[model samples]
Structure formats: C-alpha cells, structure tokens
Target: MPRIELRTEIKAIKEVVFDLSRSIDLHKISTEHTNETAIAGTTSGLIGMNESVTWRAKHFGIYQNLTSKITEFDRPNYFSDEMVSGAFSEFKHEHHFEDSNDGTLMIDLFDYKSPLGVLGKLADKIFLEKYMTDLLTERNRIVKEYAESDKWKQVLTK
Candidate 1:
C-alpha cells in the first residue's frame, strides 16, 4: 500500500471547503480532464455517510468504473471514503479540515493498494503514486478556487 498525504491552505472557511470537497458536482468539474462522471448512486450534490457513487472515467487510455462509499463523516471536520469496487485492490481517502488564521487548513490522506502484487509496487515507485498525487492536488486546487470566492455558492447552493 502507498500513502500520499497533502496539506493545502485555503482562504475560506472550513464549512465551505468541506461542502465543496464532498460535492458530487464539484468533483465532476475538477475531473473534467478525465471525463469523470458520476454514473449512479448519489450522482449529484453533497455525498453523506454511507452513500456510494459509481464513477465512469477514462484513465490510462481506458474507460473504467469505480464505486466508493462514504464510510465516515463529521461535518466541517473530517470524513473518509473507501472504495467499494475499483481497479485498485483497496483504497481509502480521508479528508481533514482545521481552522487557521488565514482561513482553513485542508488535509488529504490517501492510502491505496494496487493489484498485481510486485508489479503494483513497481508502478507506485515509477509513476502511479505521482499520478494519484497530481490528481488529488488538482482537485484541491479546484476546491480552493471555489471556496475562496463566491463560486462556492454555485456548487453548495444546489
């Protein structure tokens, strides 16, 4: 398993950032490059504890489907989503938020185990880890963008 942790500072309240993080609509916007779309279950709006969403996206030149469910949630503070079925052997993503002088400190802890055993380890060392990191970083950038401005209303108001 590989763990990737990231911290991002945003000039927005934790509540706003939290909502944006779980917003299904915001997720689609952040992953437009991958043509990621919520194909079933909690397809739009904020995803709450126990809710699952199936996403269809193009990755590595192939289309894939992954379903993940919100396993834990604490409003404006922490939450976690674990993969129900996906390409990876298993994966869990934890989101944490804390108030800061500037606004909010957002943290992401992503842990995943790729399939194929040894080959998966090699993939992580070579590029998969970085690829996943980049994807999460971009998503956070978009979250910050929305939270720091009035744009957040567009996603949360619905």
Candidate 2:
C-alpha cells in the first residue's frame, strides 16, 4: 500500500473549509481536467456519513468509475471515505481539520493498495504515487481557494 499525506493551511472558517472539502460540486470543479462527474448516489452537495457517490472520470486516456462511501464523519473536524468499488484493491482517505491562528489546518491521509501486486508496487514507485499526490494537492488548493474567497457561497448555497 502507498500512503500520501498533505497538510493545507487555509485562511477561512473551519466549518467552511470542511464543507468545501466534502462538496461534490466543488470536487467536480477542481477536477474539471479529469472530466470527473458524480454519476450516482450523493451526486451533489455535501456528502455525509454512510453516503456513497459513484464518480465517472477519464484518467490516462481511459474512463473509469469509482464508488466510495463516507465511512466516518465528525463535523468540522474529521471524516473518512473508503473505496466501495474501484480499480484499487482497497483504499481509505481520511480528512482532518484543526483550528489554527489564521484559520484552519486541513490534512489528508490517503492510503491505497493497487490491484496488480508487484506491478502495482512498481507503478507506485514509478508514477502512481506522484500522480495521486498531485491530484490531491490540486484538489486541496481549490478547496483553499474557495474557502478563502467568495466562491464558497456559490458551492455552499447549492
């Protein structure tokens, strides 16, 4: 398994940052390059505990569908989503938030196992890990952007 961790400090309210992080609408906007869309289940708005969402996206010239459910949640503090069905053998993404002097400290802990045993390890070492890291980083950047600006109202209101 490969684990990727990221910490982002955002100058915004903790509740706002938390909501933006779980916003399906914000997710779609951040991943526009991947053509990601929520195809089923909690397709829009904030995803809560036990809710699942199936996303269809194009990656590496291939289209794939991944379904994940929010397995754990604690408002404005922490949450986790686990892969229900996807290309990965198994995966869990944990989101953590803490109060900071300026605003909030958002952290992401993503742990995943690839399907193809040895080849999967190779993939992670070669590129998959970095790819996933970049993807997560960009998503966090977008969340920070929205939470710190007026853009958040558009997402939270809907």
Candidate 3:
C-alpha cells in the first residue's frame, strides 16, 4: 500500500470547507479534465456518513467505475471513505480539517494498493504515485479556490 499525505491551508470557516470537500458537484467540477461523473448514490450535494457514490471516469485512457462509501464522518472535523469496488485492490482516503488562526487547515491521507500484485507495486513506484498525488493536489486547489470566494455558494447553497 502507498500512502500520500497533503496539507492545505484555506482562508475559510472549517464548516464551509468541510462541506465543500464532500460536495459531489464540486468534485465533478474539479475532475472535469478526467470527465468524472457521479452515476449513482448521492450524485449531488454533500455526502454524509454511510453514503456510497459510484463514479465513472476515464483514467490512463481507460474508462473505469469506482464505488466508495463514507465509512467515518465527524462533521467539520474529519471523514474517511474507502473503496467498495474499483480498479484498485484497496483504497482509503481520509479528510481532516482543523481551525487555524488564519482559517482552516485541511489534510488528506490517501492510501491505496493497485491490482496485479507485483506489477501494481511497480506501477506505484514508476508513476502511479505521482499521478495520484497530482490528482489530489488539483482537487485541493479547487477546494481552496471555492472556499476562498463567493463561488462556493454555487455548489454549497441549496
């Protein structure tokens, strides 16, 4: 398994940032380059604990569908989602938020294991880790952008 951790500082309230982090609409926008879409389960709006989402997207030039369920959630503080079924043999992502003097501190812990045993390990070492890191970075950038501006209302407001 490979674990990637990232810390992001956002100038916004923890609650708002937390909500944005779990918003399906925001995720779709952030992953537009990959043409990712929520095809089932909590397709729009904030995803709460125990909710599962199935996403279809093109990755590595191949279309894939991944279903993940939120296994743990503690409003505004932290949440963790684990893969139910997907290309990878295992996957878990934890999102943590804390109040900072300036705003909020968002942390991501992504752990995954690819299929195909040894070949998967090679892939992780060769490029998969970097690719996944980039994807998470892009997602965080979008979250920061939305949390810092009124644009957040577009996805967060009901």
lDDT of 3: 0.97
lDDT (tens digit, per residue) of candidate 2 on 21-74 = 999999999999999999999999999999999999998899999999999999
Model 1, runs deviating above 4 Å: none
RMSD of each candidate? Answer: 0.5, 0.5, 0.5
In the predicted model 1, the residue pairs found to clash are: none
Query: What residue pairs clash in candidate 2, if any at all?
Result: none
Compute the lDDT of residue 100 as modeled in candidate 2: 99
Q: Quote the lDDT for 33 in model 1.
A: 99
Candidate 3: the clashing residue pairs are none
TM-score of each: 0.99, 0.99, 0.99
lDDT of each: 0.97, 0.97, 0.97
- Residues 1-158, model 1: lDDT tens digits: 79999999999989999999999999999999999999999999999999999999999999999999999999989999999998999999999999999999999999999999999999999999999999999999999999999999999997
Q: Output the worst ten-in-a-row residue range by lDDT, candidate 3.
A: 149-158
